[model samples]
Target: MARAHWHFPRTALAEHYLNVFDVGISSHLAFIAPRRKGKTAFILQDLAPAAQQQGYLCVYASLWGDPNAPHESIVQALEQAIDACASESKIKRMLSSKVRKAAISNEMLGRVEVEFANNPKSAGTRDLTRIDDLVTQLEKAAKDRTILLLIDEIQHLATSDDFSGLAHSLRTLLDRRQGRVKSIYTGSSRHYMHLLMSTQSSPFYHFANLHRFPDLGEDFCAFLQNKMASEYGVAVAMGSLVKAFGDLDHSPYWMQRLVERLVTEKCPLREAMNYTLELLDAAEGFEETAKTMKPVDRLVFLELADNGNPFSRALLSRIEAQTSNKGIPGTVQRALARLMEASLVSQIKKGEYHIEKPGLRRYLEKQVGSAPSR
Candidate 1:
């Protein structure tokens, strides 16, 4: 129960972030990474455990878990933590089953997982005093331990103006708590995270010292290699595994799926990787997401993926010829905006972007490559 054997612990990284909190560099820390790159796993498995060991009473939740009302999710975590803290025995487990259920229930970017919740029945709203009151109660409940709130998929708060109130209230509440309540927030998009935490207009502006969640490296691959050898008796070549990890966008979840096939089928690495891509494309529903885009949107998304300037004259000319949209700039702007809203793309600064769903690039390529010449 210390740490999952399969989980390669980043104890130093975890402690480093907490040390920042301890020194008052910032009580709030925000880390952004694309989906399925092990952000959630690191927060729950590595970071939370480390904070608890440091005598912090941690309450963890994912806004994606209860998409309808993100406020409710935070309140629930606080309430759960309070209950758990009241009982010395339950405090150790720390709402493990409940928090993880939230994590697993919504794993994909915006479509299948937390993305499913973006279109809530209504705008995201939080009861200010309720969240404040819960945290206050938790402080009393936790006794000597500092209260730590770990919120995942925090970028959703920046997705709409509707969440502005919740964003404002939570930041204010945490600020008022002063070091009483410390938090670590994990987000899936740097673009949205920028809108959430970096923009001066945002309540969270300068509220949390932000960090890019580092991707799992070769050590992660080595761990997988050992796990496969020791548990599954599958001998996978090291170079092959490393290349596949890069091919899979360095995502641990997909890599693990590739490993699963190796264990059961005892198949060649290439065969397993192909199978994983097929599974990844399907799981991400890239085809279905594409069906929703405009022709220009599809073209622009792929252009960004291929590292072509979307506003280049050639691309604009192509868009005009293909879609017959005369307002080329307007059309392209809307297309990029739609892709961002769809959670298919993310902006780095102004014009630059990182594909939120990289798998979509492959899908678009197949569509283009398979098309009859126009």
Candidate 2:
């Protein structure tokens, strides 16, 4: 069993579902959720083992690149994957040599070259060319093995071509009789991903194995309980911990923070509940100020949080009117713009909005629930 904090067995259910799907080839999976929900951990836990077991080369890319381009992100992930898989001395030696060679001979470099022992003539430049070259390199890397490409924060990818190109490139590899590649695409912003993969204009339309990383469930909670018992040598009150999760309101980040605080304080579960509420109360003024922001900003925050985790623009507008007594469309939109600027709300999907904070939903729920039953 993996560490309770780092791995989720619940992901196995997703893997099983993907394997059973009739998508007709190696599946592209998207694990979508809000931030700090263990989506990245889930990807790492599953993708790493699958790559090693299937004898596949895995590239885990972060889209937040040096220049913030999709292509750059891919290259970064490639270099990392190569360095990680390469023999330690060999990688250091090869990279050192590549840098040395590039510096010494200024050969009209339109593209950068990462040459391996088996493939010497490869020069990768431009996004498309680099992906093509990388695929070639990955093929060489996975001699008698499969290849797995795991891209994280894929929502940062802009343009239909960015994703479409990826899908088309993967299609080429999968179409081959000697194919040895599988992929998992993950993003924290589900709304953006839906627009990318589900939209008719998207190159990745129907190209991925859609998977939702669920909240920590009973089994995971039980795992946490066992870990607490063994690690601290104290039997945790499982019921209290469960109740704590409910009270923290099912936010994974907050849930983890609560556990950390409990462990640090050595507080009993019941005591921890009181302590947690106190923490929330202590932080309320600042949090409320953070929400007060501007009228438009506050409106956007409330709209997203109150409407749902994510709401389409139309839905948001509808709710704005329903909730506002002013009945001014321009006023509501301006308020939303302010919220977006303040970073109190984020557009997870194009033309859709979502709250960026945890525990905020409950605060809004109470406020709305008490509003003259409107």
Candidate 3:
């Protein structure tokens, strides 16, 4: 039997962005969402396909695709997009190289692999220069239609000093070709995303219109219900599905896993929800992360988890009482810095922070003592 393709139609959202581009409001767009929220899948499956149908040359580059050097990934994706546009034969060759035969499955393609070219020992100025040239080539190749560049994990460029020059070059490219080249950038880290866009010293500051990528909403829940009933004869309650979705932080990736347990293992809804929560906890390594925190940092995390204001006098008093140390602003600042460094929390603004992981609050509540309501 052929493998089933499960997709949620986010093409309407994509079209809305394109319309934003059409209205001359903002040629560039940026999406900020937490990890495993299906941002990449939305780009690859829905947005890219929609753009293609509308005669836009869509190219996707993931900065983290090459951990050692991210510029290589950008260069490779642009080159592939150029190749696909150059000739029909070249596109066929590229597709053949990317798609492979499955061993024992009816699936025609195993997995599409995107291979990046080798980078030099130090990929600094040279790679950045090449990226600039590649963008120009892609623009030239896209004669009539616009070239849509979808960059994933774009926060990587802003986080590391090594890619600062590339960031500036990218900003220059987008600025120079505002009408011809439109780009959509997606990042999992709001903290880094803010650094990229909010800081005056950053290259991409105010480069694009920022939009919060929404979670899989009721439509996805309805899709899950219909898919379950039609495909596996499993009629799960809508509320149970919605609860599982909420428990998993509205991540479609984990929701699929919960549905899989219901279908394959015949697990009840409550048991599957508990199992999914276990999987989520294991994946986040919350317990291990808490073990690494210093006593004061852990206390600060608990305080923030309970929605206590970090800069409030009440919080300082609680911190001093719990840690038996003078709860000066300097002490709280240091603890907050450490928590942000551990990726457990993120500073949204001055003296304002949020837990990066949604499930982290529940995890901390179970491990540590609970606090007063927000």
Candidate 4:
């Protein structure tokens, strides 16, 4: 049998977010945090439930959920909400098998956002008028309850030029129903999220209040300690647990996996930590990624990870010295382009960037010295 879920509830935080929406401070909210940081869990387990209890008609979508039909993420959520208004049997029959496996209220875990939306190449073909009509229908079905839209990975819309039209349409769609529809968006890529919401030329500019999605802290560690001792009969020292969490970059996803390692393998915390790191490095493809990195790419990646200027003359000279290539602005530019294509780094602004795979840095630190591929 599967182990019972050990959720650390953030009911207070959920209420705080809901109250922000309730106060009409901003109908649109953009929350940014890295992946595996429990942002989605908080939304599904805490935020969405609280909203529903308070009479919210919650519709959640993950923009990248359907690899084949990504444009349909928002539409799909709306349709599922409509189906939810019908009889249980009818709803099951009308919706796909994915909807039935939901973990939270109407949150299609398979295509999750807790609710969220996405598209890259041609999600622009989405029908805006249909979206408007769907919202109207959901409003009627909601019986005057406010509609809360939980859109996940929303930064995907800003990653490609093709999604420009869709983004604009989505902005207009929300603008028209300012009071009726409230939205909370979560994005893992801080760079793209900034582009989507902060860039003046972007459709989403000033469209929402951007808030940093806080990471799981000591309380999360405490909760895990309680679960490990009570549920699995594994006694973990509080200091060790906190240190483990700190070592894993405070990622709840990996920390939970670490707990699983402790329970199943019946090993010490240090052994479990080592095992989890191996799993982490492998699961994130860090080893494979390292093999493909050119010396310049590695240098540029580390520079960006350190939040240092890749274009600085000093760093440019370092790259040239390390790779034996002419360390010029053009060279660094090319390296940056390659890193972006690798999906391991994000250029938040003209000359600014943030590391996408932080785990990769740790892997590289162990595998290769900072001096390029040398």
lDDT-wise, the better of 3 and 4 is: 4
Error of 3 at 349 (Å): 2.1
Q: RMSD to native for every prediction?
A: 3.4, 10.4, 5.5, 4.7
The lDDT of each candidate is 0.80, 0.55, 0.76, 0.77
Scored by lDDT, the top model is 1
The lowest-lDDT stretch of 10 consecutive residues in candidate 3 is 103-112
Model 2 regions lying over 4 Å from their true place: 1-11, 17-26, 65-67, 83-127, 159-180, 249-251, 270-325, 328-358, 363-374
Q: Give the true-structure RMSD of model 1.
A: 3.4
Clashing pairs in 3: none
Question: lDDT (0-100) at residue 74 of candidate 3?
Answer: 86
Score every model by TM-score. Answer: 0.87, 0.65, 0.86, 0.84
Off by over 4 Å in 4: 1-4, 86-126, 311-317, 327-330, 369-374
Cα lDDT tens digits, model 2, 1-374, are 21234344554654564454335554566777765565555555554544454355566664533222455667766766555565545434533343333223322221111110122122233666676677777667656655667776666543233344554554565555343456777775544576676767655677776767677765666766776678766467777667777777555545655666666777777776667665654444434544465433444566566664323566456545665434355655666676655445556456677665546555554555343232
User: Candidate 1 — what's its lDDT?
Assistant: 0.80
Between which residue pairs do clashes occur in model 2? 28-209, 55-146, 56-146, 296-335, 297-339
